[model samples]
Each structure stands twice: as structure tokens, then as C-alpha cells.
Target: MPRTPRSRSLRWADVAAWRLRRHHLRGPLTAPEPWQAVKDVSAALCGLHAQVMSSAEQAVAARTRLPDAGAAVREALWERRALVKTWAMRGTLHLLPAHELHLYVAALRDDRRQMGDRLLAQQGLTPGDVAVVLEALPTALGEDRLTREALAERLTAVTHDRTIGEKVRSGWGVLLKPAARRGLLCFGPNDGRNVTFCAPRYRLGADDERAERSTPTDPAQALGAVLRRYLHAYGPASPDDFARWWGTGTPEVRAALSALGDAVTATDIEGHRSWALRDDVADMAPAPTGDGPLVRLLPAFDPYIVGPSRQLVSLLPHPALRSKVSRTAGWISPVLILDGMIGGVWKAQRRVRHTEVEIEAFVPLSSGVRRRIAEEAEGLLAPGDGHGITVRFA
Candidate 1:
């Protein structure tokens, strides 16, 4: 007989402890090789928020010992083809494991359709027009890397609609998004100031032939796989949180959860209903209370900040501080997290000789906290970029 899964009621502290463990912040930080660490963290989070290259680099560096993390990430993308940059969850640019691209695309298939419809409607385009672009994308990209402008030109030549060319070159990502969602397009090596795109399969070359054969073909299973990963890393979360993260409807999120069956168990999180992987419930045992406050200098759009959990926001010292971390116009500033709560917002300006970091605390920080913040800033600097690091509280 199958046993009924046990229910757990969680307080705020439990969530914080789970987050620390899941995010790899509480454990020893002996770092892995740069590329391996990037792959490990990306897979752990399912993907890394990568709208800004610098933010993505810092996010990875926070977990690993890559001094020049940005260059290392680029090596993974361009040289090794180990990571892929494309439009992913919430229709934002993220760095995902290259081989798993199909799974993400399959999971978001419906959401991408809805997004496509809205974007096309705004542009006064029909589904047929999007279909045309989708058809021409693979052939247009062929085996060669093409700048956005060059690809737009080629797409224009194929569609024979000059307006399509204009839209592609507008840099708004409307026309190209569908291709990325369909796994037909991804970043190519940049061409100076211009960004380029190519078919991911072409980018992977012969390696993709083997991957495609082994990749799961079922979309429902793919959706379930992505949700399981989400719950594993960011679980004890509501369907709304999952919906917000994926930019999908609640129906889809709920359906995916249902498909997981016994794998998911219900929980009460601060009086609200949440779900988590059954095994994780045991791991959420309250952490020791004696340790001093933990501090992290998280970069903009770090997963720890960008994850769609209002519960995390409630951990802020004050409600007003929310705006500082979660800014207007999709600008999430770098943050100072002290003891699992948002302590302040921070910024770093790097020069050839040194990096200057300025922190604005919502609450006064002690000298020990300030010293810890300075140490965190030092880690962000490249080797021999000078021992000079300035951290001033504003």
C-alpha cells in the first residue's frame, strides 16, 4: 500500500534555512573549476538570470572562485557550447545548459504562444506572419553566424516584407523571440558592438545529433521535469510563484504540479498553501540559532533576488526597502543581504586599478558587518586588480 505523505507547517525561519541550503550559501565554499562551477550553478537554479552579462557573471562568481567569471561564462557560451543564452522563463535572457534547451522550450511552449500572440497583435501582425519568420529562421541562420542586422536582412529577403526587416532590427526582440523559444536561435559570438544569432543545432554541430536523440520528446513530461527542478531548488512555493517565475498561467502551473503526483507534498508556509518535494521537508529542519548574521553582496538579477517569492520580500527590514532592491522598469539593483534579510542596496564601479563599492543600508550596520561587506567586495575583484577596495556606507 502507498503511504500518505506527511504535511509540514513552516515558519519564516524554515524557509530562510531552506533557501540558504538550496542556494549553496551555508556550506563550505571551496570552489570548483570555473566552467564546471558555472554549469553546476546553472543546472542547480535550472537557469541563470542573464539579461546583463555583468550581473550574470557576478551571480556565478558569488557561488564559485572565478576571478574573471564574465570571461569564463563567455568561454562556456562561445567556445565550449556548454551554455546557451536565449529568451527563457518570463521571456527574459537567461543562460541555460545548452543540451537542456529543448526541455525549457518544450515546457514554455504554450506561454511562448501567448506571448507571440500579444507581440504580433501589438505589431499588427498575424499568426501567419510569425509562422513565416519561424519557417525562414533555420534556413536564414544556416551554418553561418549572422549579426542581428544581417539576419534581419536575410529574413527580410525571404519574407519580402521590408517591415519585417525593420522589426527585427529594432532590437526589441519581438520577431526573434519566437525563434529562440522554438530553440532555433541562440547567441553567436558577438560582432563588435552588434549581437549575432545562429541555429543552436548548427552551433552544437555533430554534438546536437546525439543530444537530440536522447532528449525527451514529450512536452508534458518536459513541463513536469522543469517544475520538479523548480520545486527542488525553489519549492515550498505556491502555484502563483511558479506561474510568476515562468510567466505562464496558473492552470498550467497547477497541471504541472498535479502531474508530479506523490513527488510533491503540501505544506503550510506562514498560513499560505505551498508545495515542496517530499524529501525536502526533512531537510528543512530548523537550523542552529547561534551563528552570527550572514552577509552576501548579491549582484543585480541574482536568482536569490529575482526568484518570484513574496515571502523573501517580507524578510526585508522595512516595506519601503522593497523598492530599492526591486526597482522600477525591471531594474533590480545589487543588494546587501544580511542574515537572510535584505539589509541594503549596493553598487560597484570597477576601474583599471580598483573597484569602488558603495552601500546604502536601510538599517545601520555594525563594524563587523561592514568589514564582512568589504571582504565580499574584495572577492568580486580580479586577481592583482590591486588590493585597493573602497566600501562606503551611504
Candidate 2:
């Protein structure tokens, strides 16, 4: 029998530094053009949560050496076409690198759209109606993209069912995520305030790219690939962490881990056991306990906070204060990290003249640390967002 890998004990500091490095938050990507910045950062972080476009851009900016967050992100999205924004990963909007669309869509098996038959029935939609819309999506979104309203009208025209209108009304776009997973629909460039939809170009010739004809053609393999990617970016995570992140169950995650075989290794952070990519095992070094606090202001829903199953207590050790970080109705507040632990929670409110970032620290902060936090916050500012940044403590 093969010997089990030794479980490495990790400190919260070590976990914090490693995660910050993996996320490109320790320091931005060396240097990249507007387009490459988005692609590189998105690929590195699995993908940026795009529910709030500004937040997604800030996340990229935090990871990249690029000057203007808006310029770099929009250039990659609209001009370079290097990134595709779509509903994915727990049926939420994400900014994913364009070249990896095939891998992501393949992992999201066609049968695994977000809405179930019961929910469809609740919307007065039948499976047949959903099928008709899924089939009609590609043709309607051909060549140019269409606004949600335009697509809804065309869907109604094609299906001859007015209920399709009810399904698309919510800004959340919960019902349409299924079609997006099928690779037939994605968010197109914005027409002023209106968001559009298009069929993403999933056939890229990147080194890792495969034709629809995959080598294995096994869904588990794709699932395993996704797990490997996630582990690299946010590893030393529990099986349940991946399950929750992917909206999967224990058995599915177990099988995916099994598919990795020796590619993954077990590890422990404190008393909690988790898994990490084999290659990453060698890099898990404990940050010197004597080192001064390190700080970074992460935007709301940054992959770092959402990726590792925050409930693990590794992110925020104080159980009573958990509500401050992860709030009601799934709101993850922008956070301040000190020496790899949740030292505080923060908010960046855009004022007409300036953006004020108010921090509520759970522990006292030193002047040097506060100054560093201000500098970090300035680097994350998007172009034309505000002329200046003010840091306030509460």
C-alpha cells in the first residue's frame, strides 16, 4: 500500500501569507498590459466575482501592477476580448479568462444548470420550454450580442411563451444561469446602463485548451481539473470547502478528490485538516511569529474570503464577530487582514469628492500599520472613482 503523505502543520500566519501570494495581493503581478492583467489575475484567482462590476475590477487591480483598474479591466473585456463575464460558480456572475471557457463549461455538465424542474414549474415554465430556450439561445445571440430585454423579446418570439418574460425580469438572472453554463449565453459589452448577452467563444487554442473532443470525456476528470485549479489558488481546504464553493455534495467532492490521486496531499492548519496540491506542499512555510502585522484591504467577495469556506474559522477566528465579516443575506464585507488574520472589517464609501475607507479593527492598530493600510487602499482605487482616498478608524 502507498504510504500516506505527511500532514504539514500550518500557522494562520503562514496560511495568510501563502493565500495573499497566491491571490497576487502580497504584491501585484510584476507588470502586465491592460488585457493581460485581467487574464492573468482572473486565471490566478480561479475567477473574480463579477456580481458587482466595480468590486471585480478592484479585485483585479489589487492583484495587478496596472494603474487604472477600470481602464485595465474594460480594455481586457471590451477591447482585447481576453475575459468573459458570465454566470458561473454557484450561479453567480464571474469574470473568467476567455481562453479557459471550454474547461469551465465542460466541467459544468449540460444537465447541471442552476434551476431545477420544481422551480421552473413555479415560474410557469416546463422542461420543454426551458429546452426550447436553451436551443434558441445560440441562434438569437449569433454574431452580435443582445441586451437582456432584446434577448427576452427574441426568446418570447421563438418560444411563443410569454412566461419567459417573467423568468428574465430579475436583475439577479438566476433563471438564465443554466443557459450560460451550457456555453450558449454570456454577458456581452454594456450598452450604457444595459447589460447584453452573447455566446462566448469557447474554442481557444491555448496550450491547455482541448477541442470538444476531450481526452477523457469523463465528467469526473473535468471536475477534478476544476478542483486542482481551486486547490492551487486556495488549497489546504476541506472537501466541504470545495463542495460548498462548487455547490456540490460530499460524495461528488470525494470522487473528484479521488480522481486527483497523488496530485493532492493532506495538511493541517492548527487542528483542522485540509488538502493542498502536492507541489504546493513544499512551499508551506510558517511566517515568523515575531514579524510585524501585514495588511491588505480586500474588496467585498474577494476570492480569498469566499474561496476557502470562510466558516472554517481560519479566516475569522473570533466566532462571535463572524457576523461582521459575513453578514446577513450573503454579504461579505470588505476586510482588513493583519498578519494573515481577520484584524478588522472595512467599507469604502464613494463620496462625491472622495472615497472614504472606514475601518473597524477588532484589535488596536499601530501607526505604521495604519499608514501601510492607507497606501494599500490607494493602490486599489479605480480610475475616476474619486479624486482622493481618506482613511477613517472607528
Candidate 3:
């Protein structure tokens, strides 16, 4: 029988530092930025470090601090070649910096490319037909937005293809994934729903055009680079977590972990084995949330909610927790971050000019914490902010 992995207790403070500093907040937040800057900075505040947070919390935080906070985030967003999204890393979304996009997307593309061949075979799409569909995308999208229907129409015209729908989906994946790999296109602001496309402003560093051109686009190389970066950023995690986040086979996760070698250290979480940066244990601490303070109204998908494992949430058990966070739904209900862990979930919606938020607690709140939660909710209920606050029990 295979030996079971060991469980190591982790310092909650270290977990907080990993979630706040290294992963999100890549650079100091800035202002007067482009859409790209806004997207990237929002990502930093929300989760460039981890996808545990929902996109809704991201929007709240982006708008919460007004000009100063929003501007800083936008400034950081535009400083990259492309921001990586829709590839690996929980198979959700992320806004990677330009210099790093290539490595991140390349790994994901390799995984997808393998699936593409299988999908293509199942769909009976000829290579020539697929190529034709792919070629038409850049022009179809042009420098303008390409809605779903518009892209479908353009693909049909270019390839004279019968399966316009499937082709559009697959071919767009081919184009966007490579663009993500090549440092060209990145996530734009949400067009009310999902992300739209925009060009990236690349920082080529000191490398000349030739040197930049010489950089490899091979997917395996990208995967290797990504493995290194993941361990570097979120070390002391288990191969299971990495596999879940990256959507790779166990063999692949193990191989990558093995390659990391001394750069990482293995420890047990409770009884389960996990990994961490070799020196990270000694170098980090949990953020000081001030003495006797416990209540915080974390936006939906707040980093504190989704970034760490359930074990980190001392008040609740993992399998017993009920709030579902699904990627396809595109809706993230806000939650109460009590003592730096999820206490329950909430949501805010507009009634004409007024905004109302509904709060549901998994456990009864203390009178003091409840008051603080109301205060935090008030941030979302400011006058002229298009909302008001209300709490209800589940």
C-alpha cells in the first residue's frame, strides 16, 4: 500500500501573508489607469495570488476605496504584456502580469492542446478547417468587441464550416490561448457579465526584439516555469491542492514537485501531507488585524474566504460547509470574514437608487461582532452609492 501523506499544522498568520502580500497585491496599487490596469489591479486586490475569492468581492473592493484604491489597481493592470486568465489555476480566472503570462498560459495550453486533439477527433473537424477557423479570429474580433453571435457568424463565413458553433468555441480557444501565451491579449473589464478582450501593453524589459523573439513558446517549457512559480508563491500546499488548482494529472503534479526538490519542503497538514517554500515558514507572519477586532465584512469570494483550505477556518468543518462557489454561475455571494475565516455568506442588490444587502450567518454572531458587521456593511450602503444594507438569518 502507498504510504499516507503527513499532516502538518500551519501558522494562520503565514497563511494570511501568503494570501495578502505575495499572491495578490503584486505591486503597490496606483491610479488614472486604462482598462487593463483596472482589471489587473482588481485582480491583485481580489486574487492574483489565489482564485478562492469570487469575482463579486473583487468588484466591491475595487470600488470600495474610491479613487485612490481604484487608481492604484488600474496602474498595475496596464503594466503587463498580457494578463493570464481562463487557463489552469483552479481552471477559473486570473490576471497574470505580461512577463509572466507566457509561462502561465503555456502550461495551460499544453493541457488544453491535448484535449483539443481529442475533441477535434470527436467532432470530425479537419485540420484545414480548424486552421481556417483559427486564422479568421483576429480579424473577426479586429480591435472591437466580438460578441458570441458575431464570432459565430464570422467563423462560418471564413471556413464555410457547418459546425459553426463548435468551431467558434474551439477556434476561439486556440486563438486566445496562444495570444495569452504570446503576451498580446488579456482580460478587459467585465462587459456586465464575463471578461472581454483588450490588447496588452508589454514591458519588454531590456531585452531587444530579437531576444524577445528568441524566447520559446513550447508548452512544456511553460509548464515547468509555472510549476516553479506556483511553488514559489503558494508553497506548503499539498500536491492534491496543486493538482486541483492546476487541473493536471497526479503524475504531473508529483513530477513538478519532485523537480522543485530542495526549493520546497514537505510537511503534514493534520494527517495529510502538504508542501511549502523551504524558507517561507520562518519569513512570514499573519497580518495584524488590530487587538480585540474580529469582525470584517469581506466581499464575495474574498481572499480570506477562498484562498486557504477549510482547515484554516477554525470555526467550521470543511465537508460540512455549504456555500457553493461555482465558476459557471458568474455570481458570488459575499461572506462575513470573522476572525479571518468565513463565518457565513451575504449578497447585495439594488432597489432603484438604494442598495440592500442580505446577510446569513452559519452560526449565531456575538452582539459585538454583529455590530461590526453592520458597520462594514455600511461601506456598501453609502449615499449615492446605489445601495443600502439589510441583514437576515438563514
Candidate 4:
């Protein structure tokens, strides 16, 4: 019989450790060896491809090894053609890594295309012209960064139009995406303003032309890989959670769950269902102790929170918490994760003295725990500059 995801006794420490290591300790993404970390945690973490970089001062105060980690993570985001947007899960922008990017985008491309097409039509671009422009991009961008103006020139040249401003901008997104997929280009270094697209180290040569382009194939194997990894990190979860995370329907989720029958087991949780990795539950490794030096203030859209299913209430149950996560408008608030499992919610503002962190908690923090949280927050913000940390009980 196919088992559904049910609740089980979860070790908060283990969960915290897993989340931390996956994000922080997996090593810097820019290191040629970033993929090593990806492959290492491949079985335990999924869909969290965005890299989180911290300011140089923040890294020094926090005493982290990968102070420039965020840049690496961003590169990882582009390398995989993972759309660097906030809409992957529940409208939170995440730097989704490559593989998951391909899958989700494949399923979503048409929906996006419709939206893109509608916008283009409004800008006076016809389907035939759109096709022609896309075909001209390679030659248009040949051996150059192809800034907006440069791209416009190329489009005007092809269309023989005195004014092709809207036409160029309209086809910009369409051409750039395919260019990225073909490994011909990607986002270059950020100049403190907008991120400009540039060519990758290696151009797409003729030898690569015949190979099948990347496709988001949700094979039973791939789905099984995703399910097993989730169970390993956030185990004893129900299919509903899986469905929500994958953004797929129940039948697809069921099939994916079925594919992992041998590697997982179901358990009961307060009349609910979840699944756990059979191996981890039986022989889960003990979390290394002795107060590790690492501490992180993960941004709101950080994968640790976003990758799991919608039933996050299992871990974070307050409705206010939900509101705080969304308050940023477009930016994700920084989360204070002392030892994982959301020690508290923190908001930061640029104050005259320094950055001010307004912290709210669901439980009353003891002096010792509060001290640790404060110390961690200090490391996160400017020195002695973070204050106004309030503690409220749920």
C-alpha cells in the first residue's frame, strides 16, 4: 500500500543543523568546487539554489569563512539558468539553482510566454516579427555584451525600421532567456545598480548544437530524488506538503511518492500523516556539538524556509509570522536563525547609530538564550548598533 506523509517525532536540532549546513556550510558557490557541495547535499536539500552573500563588514563581524559567499551563490543561480526571481514558491524571490529551475520553468514557460506575449502585443510586436527578432539575436549580440542600446541597434537593423525601440525591448526577454539556456550568456558582475548580462566563459560551439537542449523532465527517478531528499531534511511530511512545494497536482505527487516507496516509511502525527527517510530515522547521525562558530541571518526568501511544503505551520505556527515574512513588499526580511528552527523574527533598518533590529518571538526567551540571540544579532548587524529587540509571547 502507498503510504502518505504523516507526522512523526522530529528532532528540532537535527532539522536546524541540516538547514544551516545546506545553506552556509555547503561552501561558497563561486568556488569551482561549488558543484561538489551541491552534489554532496543533493540528497538532503532541494530547490534552494539562490546564494546569499553578506556585506564584507557583516562577514567580518560574524567571523565567517565565506564572507563573499553571496556572489558565489548568485553565479550558481545563473549557471543553472535558474531564473533569479522571487516567484518560485509562494511569491518569494529565490535564487533557484539550475536543475530545479529547468524543471519549473519548462512547466511554466507557456504560462510565462502568454504573459510575455500579451505584454509584447501591447508594445506593438507581432508573432512573426517576434520570431524574426529572436532569430537575429545571436548575430545581433555577436562578441559583445549587447547592452539595451546595442540590442536595439541590432533589432532596428534587422527590421529596417527607423523606430524599433519598443520592438527591441519587446523581444529582449525572449532572446535573453534562450541565450542563457544555450550557455551563450549570463548575468555579469553587479555594478551596485542593475545586473547586466554577459557571455559565459565558453560559447556554444557546433559540437554542442546537435545535443538535445535542456528540458525539465520530471522522470520518476527525478521525482523520487526530490521526495527522498525532502524526507531526509524535513521528514515525516505529508503528500500535501510535497504537492505544495513541487507545485504539482496530487496525482503527480502520488506517483512521485510511490516511486520512493522502498526508501521511505510513513508515520502518524496527531492524526496527520508524514514520511521519513527509513535510513535516517533508523540511524540518523548525531549533530556535531561544541558551539560551532557559524551564525547566519537568512533573508526571508532563503531556501531553508521556502523549499519545504506549505504546511510550514508544523514548525512556525503564528499568523503574525506570515505577515512579517510578507511585509518586505519585494525584499525578504532577514531571519535570525540561532540554531535553526527560527529562533525569532528580526527586522532591520538603517539607523543613525547603526542598523536597528526589531526582534519578535513566539516564546519568552530566557536570559541566556536571549543573550545568545543578541550576540548573534550583533554579529548580523553593525556593532552595538542593533537594538530595539522586543520579545513578545505567543
Candidate 5:
């Protein structure tokens, strides 16, 4: 396969519009059944950042029309087994569809190895120690869910290594993540306040068996699938962006992009080299012309804000506003996005009866925009009384 010819230069506006369109924010919202909606959006965005469970649910609710969408998301995880929370790209917890687990696990193989090495060194353990835990995990977990503490006890008994049990009980998830990446473990139902773990095979049950029978287990093919999905949802991006997003080396990302061949087209975004889907580049010429600003109240760690970028600081311009919205102690706060730029920071507090949403805008927002922000907050608190939602400008 030959590489697609480079398209004309793309501006910031083009990239922003492409993001909105690709994120399913431009057109009429299609409200599918709750589980289907979660699956659709999760797959579309590659995976949902689930470090904060409430935030992940809210992110899905913002895209779908389901009332009490958050509850539905939980149902999908605890009941339907449609979505599985596991350590994926960047070695962070994410909600990936159960059917696609194999692909993502395989795609993160290199990064997982690197992370495992660092973690093992930090724990003063060897690869042999990790293998012992891995070997014991499946039978220890069996068809039952075990809390981290309980699982650690089992590991201690099985491996007969007190240090392994101590590390597991420490809750760092260092040794456990390797097992997850290798498809030996995943999140199970919560045991009261504590989270539990079980084998992916046990969690998926018949679904896992079906997937194993049908899904290709080739790592190279899985890498290609992940790259294609990433580009589809967050393209017109550079290999550096992909590398950053995946937490993999740039050389590996470039190799995957190369294997994609003409499926990806090279272009210059804001004077920086980038790549996008061939069809997307063909349609993005002249960009999506519009002057009306689009306002979106995106939750913390939303995919739109988390996607790869070269000049995010320039998008906000103001130093203080940039700091507020961007990383601060590894936390990406909820943001108010106006026309593809980080316009302000927002925080929400759910009271007993109502949800209080406070917005801190970098620049004075127009009355209409403020109303739109209020409307968004109301929608976020929906299936509950709209009047119960309060939006305060700080």
C-alpha cells in the first residue's frame, strides 16, 4: 500500500472543527439504548478515561440522551458485562468494551512491559516474582471475585511470598496491572466499598469464549486496529500525539502509522506536521466555515481535552487560564470550551437536593453563552428537576 499524498496546510480552526465532527458533537444527537450508547461512544472515542468513575459516567451522559445515564453505565459494567474496566493505554484505568479487550491489551503490550519493569524495580521485585503472581492469579480468582486484600492473601498462600502479598495489599496496582494487560485479570463486582478482581474469562463468561473463538489474536493486527480507531476519533494529529496518548515510544507509533499505509494522509496542522484519515483530509478542505462559537461544558479528563495536541497553551492564550484548565498535580479539571478553545474552568458539587455548578470564565461571557452554560448544567443534572440545578458564575 502506498502512502496518501499530503493535503494542503490545515489551520487551527480546521483541526478544531474536525475534532467536533469526529467527537459526534456537531450533528443531531442519536440516543440509543443505554448499553448501546455506552458501547457506541466508548468505541468511538477509543475508550473512556475511567480514573474517576463519576466523571466517566458524566462524560457519557453529556453525549447521550439517557436520563440517569450514569446508572446505566454502572449497569453495563456490573450487570451486562458489556464494558470492562481495565488498565489500558497509559497504564490507567479505562472503560473498554469487553469485546474489544484483546485488541487494546495487545496494543499496550510495549508500554505495559515498560511500566511493569519500572514498577517491579520500585517494588524491589524481579520478573520471576511477577510471574509467580501471574501464575497464581487465575486459580486464586477462579469464577469468584476477590477484593484486592483477599486476592493478595490468596497470592501469598499460592506464591508463598509474603512480599508479594504485601505489595498487592498496598494497592499500588503495580503487579496487578501486568496480569490485567496479559488478559489474566480485570475488574469484578465491588465487594461493598472495596473493588474486586477476577479473570477476564470469568468476567466475560460466554462472551469471552465467543470472542476468543472469533477475534484474531495477532498483536500486529491489533496495533493496526488501535491506530485506526485513534485516528478516527482524534486525528489530524502527529505521531508524537499518538505516542503521548498511548504512552509508547515515537518510533513504535511511527511504525504503526506506516503500516496503516494510504489509510492515513499526512498534512500540516498549524505549521506542525500531522496526519489524518484520507477521507477526512479530502472533506476538510476549506474547513467547516462558521463564526458562531460552540460552547461545551466538558467534564474532567474528557477525551476532547485529553486528545493529543501540540499547541494547547496557545489555544487558551492567557497564562492563568491555561494553568487552571491544563494539568495541575496531574488533575485535568472540568473545562468550559468555547469554539474549540479552553475558555474557563468549572466545578460541580452535588448537594442533597440540587447540584451546584460554578463557572470561572477567563473572559466575560455573553448573556447568551451564560444561558447556554446554564442549560448544559441543567442537562447534566437531568431526570432530576431542572430547577434543582444551580449555575453560579464566579
Candidate 6:
């Protein structure tokens, strides 16, 4: 495939560079402090899919110039209450900016799933049983956070249903995610190895945690707002892409994007119809020659890699090799990106004082590309920890 501009269409290369700029992936962001840098990256991508905490931290570190990336993530999440970690989009764990959590939740709470009912029935449970759990959540989750087992006990005691307790105890968020998406439940700080749950108000540290429910966000308006943000970050995309990323039905996403009307502009990318924020159409210039950010690495499940509407071309242009990136059991491999396309896959591990990285490229890498990959790997290190990296190709 010739990576060139098709006549009368937005240059895919230009779109790639523009998205890199939007994601702060073009280079390190210079911010006054750490949290600001972290928030900037998180906000740009809507939020970080924090299925793996280190991957989420590296997602920010690689894009921003932070002295101590890990500490900064902890401060926002644990100390400053600036970030909220919860089950978000597609029912996966995410680290969202505290201020923006409601926007995502507002859209999510309104989008009901038939899967929940089906799962409930499979467990011999009913909507009323789940409703009782939802209603009791306000009280069950108090000022202090409760572990899953602890919360299960409370729900079982309150609902007086031993079956529900067993289901909650045995399952991995199957019964609980409904309350989570409904804004009735969220993750609390760790209890050693045990994961805890609490009300969103409590984790956010609002006074009267139980009483401080946020004002309801209009689903239509909220969906509209989120769609605009998505288009800006991952535009030249379709509603189906957004639906896949957002874990919602295509019809709802299509309706929301249509509702945007003049706020969005339709365009073509490689002959496929896509839409972008109308105000941003002018900024979509053609890509300059030479590889842009030749060898950037994205950790597993990084938003740019897992994004529904992003790195476009229906999960990369190489449909033949899509299985390597989008693996089984919903695992997105840590990828090596060459000029905004999935060039290869890579993995890294910390070995005491040094970090070891192995790269397996789909096509041969030039000397220049190899050097850039080494530098990109070095950037993943923590400051003042004797930053040393060993790069190997497999």
C-alpha cells in the first residue's frame, strides 16, 4: 500500500500527525508539574484504560516530561483525588480525571445493556434482586470503603438474599458492574491484595459521601459532548468505531454523531467516509515527507492502540496482521509504531537495576528506526534509578 495522499481526501499521513499532536505523542509535553502533565494526556484520550496500572502510568510518562511518573500517578489517584479509577468504557478498568468522571458516567448510565439481564438470569437472579442491591448501595457503601467480600456481606444482609451474596462473591464484577455503571459503585483504595468498592462520592472525597450524589447529566447532551471529544482525539472515524470503543450499540452512537449536525464535518480517509470536529478540519494538513516519530512504543491497552475509532483503518490498515495486535481474551499487545502504523510488537521487563526490551518487527527496521526504538525504550525508565535498557530483537 502506498502511504501517499489520495487526491481530494484528507491525507492519512496528515491525520496521523494531527492525532499524534492531539495525543501528545509527537514528543514530550513541557508542563510546570507532574499532575498537569498526567491530566493533559488522560484528558486527551478521554481517559486511560488502566487494566494494567503500569501501562497507564507509562502512557503518560512516554508522552510527558515528568520527573517521577509513578509517584505523580499515585498522587492524583490516591493523595490529591484528582483521578478516579473505576470500571469504565466497555466495562474495563480506567483512570479518569476526577472532574471529567461524571461526563463518561452520565453517558454510560443511560446506555443500558441486555447483557446484564441475560447474565442475571443465568445466575438465577432477577431485576428486582439487582434493584435491591442498587438501592442498598447508597447505604452499603458508606464513608469507609468496603472490600468485595465486605460489600457482598452488606448487600446479602440488607437484601436478605443468600443467593445474591454467593453470586457477588463468586463472580468477577458480573453482578457488580451494573451498579458501577449506574454510578452507584466504584473502586476504593487497595486493601493489601483485596480490591475494595465504594460510592463515587466517597472515593472522590466529597463531604457527606453518601448524600453528595452528583446532579444527573442529560444523556443526550452528555453523549453529544463525549462524541465531540472522541472525534477530536480519534476522528476521520465512523459511529461504529466510536460504538466499539464506547461499548455501546452502533445505532445510539450513530444517532449521537448525527445530532452533532454542523458541529461535525464529514470527510474521506482512504476512500472511507469519516467525520471530524468541523472547527478542526482546517488543521488537517498533508503529512511532510520522512518518518514522523519513527519508532514510538505504546504499552499494552494504551488508549491509542485500543481506541475504537483510532489509528484508523478498522484497527490498523493491515487487516491480515490484526490478530497480532488485537489478540485473544481482549489483550492488546505492546506495539512498536512506525510512522503511525503498527510496525511491530514489543515487550519489556524490569530486571533489578536494568530494563530489558525485545522487539519483533513485521518488516525489517532500518538502522535509524532501530536507534529510535532504543531511545524510546530508554524514555520508559524512572528518573534517578540508574536508567539502563537492553534492547534485543527477536
Q: Score every model by TM-score.
A: 0.92, 0.91, 0.68, 0.62, 0.91, 0.90
Could you give candidate 6's per-residue lDDT for residues 274-319 as a string of tens digits?
7788788788874454663456888888888777534434436466
**Superposition TM-score, candidate 1 onto the true structure:** 0.92
lDDT values, one for every candidate? 0.78, 0.76, 0.52, 0.49, 0.78, 0.76
Report the C-alpha lDDT of model 4 over 1-394, residue by residue, as the tens digit: 3654543454545555554554443233232454333322322345443333342123222323333334434443445432232234332223333334444443433323233566557756656655565576566666665556666777678667645545556554543553443334455545555445555433323322222144434455555665676666665567777666655566766777777766777755445566667765554333555554233555545546655535444445465575555454434455555555555566666656555566666555666666666665654453342343333223
lDDT (Cα, tens digit) per residue for candidate 3, span 148-239: 55556765666666585566565545434444443444565556665566444323344323443544567656555565555555555666
| Model 4 / residue 336 / CA error / Å | 3.1
Stretches of model 3 off by over 4 angstroms after superposition:
1-64, 67-93, 113-132, 135-145, 160-218, 231-234, 284-290, 301-318, 323-333, 380-387, 391-394
- Report clash pairs, candidate 2: none
lDDT of 3 at 142: 58
Clashes of 5: 0
Question: Which should have the higher TM-score, number 1 or number 2?
Answer: 1
Which scores greater on TM-score, model 1 or model 6? 1
Candidate 6 deviant stretches above 4 angstroms: 1-8, 122-124, 205-216, 286-293, 309-317
lDDT of 1 by residue, 100-161 (tens): 78788877665653465677788766677678889988777788899988998998888788
User: Looking at candidate 2, what is the lDDT of residue 135?
Assistant: 82
Backbone steric clashes in candidate 4, count? 14
Go through the candidates in order and give the C-alpha RMSD of each one to the true structure: 2.6, 2.8, 5.9, 6.8, 2.5, 4.3
The true-versus-predicted C-alpha distance at residue 210 of model 5, in Å, is 4.3
Put down candidate 5 lDDT per residue, 53-137, tens digits, no spaces: 9888888877775687788888888888888999888778899988888888776654544565666787777777777887998
Q: What value of lDDT does candidate 1 attain over all alpha carbons? A: 0.78
- Stretches > 4 Å off in candidate 2: 1-5, 110-113, 121-124, 169-172, 202-217, 288-291, 382-386
